[model samples]
Target: MSEERVGFFTDTSVCIGCKACEVACKEWNAIPEDGLSLTAMSYDNTQALGASTWRHVAFIEQPRPEGRTELPLAQGESTAQETPVGGDGELRWLMSSDVCKHCTHAACLDVCPTGSLFRTEFGTVVVQEDICNGCGYCVPACPYGVIEQRPHDGRAFKCTMCYDRLGAGREPACAKACPTESIQFGPLDELRERAALRVDQLHEAGVTDARLYGHDPDDGVGGDGAFFLLLDRPEVYGLPPDPVVTTRDLPAMWQHAGTAALSLLGGLAACFALTGRGRR
Candidate 1:
């Protein structure tokens, strides 16, 4: 293990809905373009992060409360009484560049029968294309719905956090191409401290809703290598509110199964002993 662990800190508040990260990822990784003609997803045609879509720029337009609804007024007064909106009332555009969480206890890595998915020195998870047998075990194991099989090739694929770039001491392609520095990459510990300061600053500036997601080391999946500073609830950005690793109970389940098997054998042995006594 490397002494230093690296990861991503995506400050979604600063994202400008620019798909530069998305394009750069595909270009640098040589990923195929998907759903070129699909029209179902508005603004974000790439949709959620998947096999080919490594970095998905999500555009969310939240409705601002109707400005100052007028109350009934007397005929002679001829004036509209303005209704005050609560402090929560606000309007803003939210843009987040979504990518693989690369969880510390990555379920995908846990479920890979061939060991194709493994953690790198930087603590980011990667999938070895050649080693993948396309058994599809990893697809359902991922809590974030990341890591999908390429239809044509039947091989699972996802963001490797640009492991190749990191090996060369360079930032991930998406982070490098970001014009707003929305995607910042560095040592994981340093990034967490930086993200905390950013959230505090936003709160001080009256952006009370700004909060960090997936930064807690003790979170469900032991925190994500790529965490985010989300302006709204995670689900609003198409992310799960509380994601838990699917295989967290495997050990307990196995223990119970083993105990049950022993109990059944003991019962069978007792029956055989009783029959032998009768025969004697």
Candidate 2:
């Protein structure tokens, strides 16, 4: 609306698996701390995004064979030929910080029975806690599985895209806290352009797998206020490959229902008319 406001441009390639963004978000937003128990699933303490954890850092470790054995070398036997060092064939770590997408056509906003969820002038979606009736309609409406109900309050919550900070003309705390600038925030259009250039740069650097996700304006949800640049498939990062807004089919569904209702009424009227004629 206002020259297309900016949003996040997370470069997963630069993320160092640091939970600083996660910690900062919790600290600044006064979010409750989730359990510290580790799932032994990589180094990620916070397994995923939830009511308490907004920013989740995913750590992925890939292993590659160091050598090519001609005759299936024994467990302890070293191959006579050295395979290679770190290169195209070598394994590397891929880290990404996941957060609410703030979709353009947010289904959560559409499905909210109350006006708890609404779009801001910045075109970001926000849930008004005071207005939320805790009906939980928004929880599943989100295609990205973002908004969730708090256990204690039963009220839905999610990242506000740091609306207060944006209002104060300050960048989101997570973006500011990122040491490597992995999370950059600005106007959505500008961020998209920047993300595209970053993808190109990564490709040129032989990181051919680097690509942008959720940045397409023509995408199912229109586009996302917060998008990402990833080094692997979205599902590898626990994100959906193709997220269609759940409410996209609502209009067609209603139209079909209306047609069916009309046809039924017309049939009833014809039956009544034929019966009346017989009575006459």
Candidate 3:
């Protein structure tokens, strides 16, 4: 029997930016530690996803309400805006956990020269590290810019959606560790149904900005296996507003190229025949 399609429904509205998902991911995957450096970009230290960093949580601090007090600065700190505060002003801090989409039409799988990227029985995407040649084709083919080459190993890597855990009938570590149930994992169809109801509930509660991203089967990437319910614009969480599969137009491009080449060859043959006749 075919395994049901399992995936993630990351509800950004409920995420607290605690980075528990990040920690759980690294622990389960045995990924290298990344606590060495501070980039001075908000509370975010692990900036983006890579081989070592499978799950990244983005922190976006929105300025307080208009005519609010100027944010106080530390004695020796930069004068830039401080952490968002809602006590005296209407401040909103947006936090989101980003992962590989495991797209329905996976561009990484299409561009993997070594056949390292493969689809799982659960309808997720995974990469075989030993089989990877590190060609880096999949890096650019991904519209979300999720895949990356490890510095030491030079092998492309991203979230596997915890294929191993799924096989054992367990949820991905990140989802299991989420304190707010923000990162929900289950059958894709069921999640979609549940997410819709959540959105409706939020709307009824006067949260007009609530919306779902990457859930449509007819979307550009044919929909993401791991989708999201966002309270703000996708860009607010460092997600592309519209992600399109990079390989969607390859067949049409090749067809046009072949037609042009055939036309050029026919013209060359005609010229050669005419020259031969004149010489005779």
| TM-score, predicted candidate 1 vs. hidden true structure | 0.89
User: What TM-score do all the candidates reach, one by one?
Assistant: 0.89, 0.89, 0.89
Model 3: per-residue lDDT, tens digit, 1-280? 2899989999887788999999999999888886635558688889888777899988888854433233212122323333334555476677889999999999999888888999989999999999999888999999999999987768987898888999899999999999988899999999999899878766654456779999999999999999999878888788889889999999999999999999999999999999999999
Candidate 3, residue 62: Cα displacement in angstroms equals: 1.0
lDDT of each: 0.85, 0.83, 0.85
- Stretches > 4 Å off in candidate 3: 64-88
> For candidate 2, lDDT tens digit of each residue in 1-280?
6635768888887788888999889988998888955779678898888778888888887753344212111123433344455546566667899999989889998899999999887888888999999999999999888888998879998988788988888889899999888899888788888888777765554456678999998998998889998867899888999999999999999999999999999999999999999999
For each of the candidates, give the backbone clash count: 0, 6, 0
TM-score of 2: 0.89
True-structure RMSD, every candidate: 8.2, 7.4, 7.4
Model 1 clashes, total count: 0
Candidate structures ordered by TM-score, highest first:
1, 2, 3
In model 2, where do residues sit more than 4 Å from their true spots?
2-4, 64-83, 86-91
Q: After superposition, how far is residue 60 of candidate 2 from its true place, in Å?
A: 1.7
Two-way lDDT contest, 2 vs 3, winner: 3
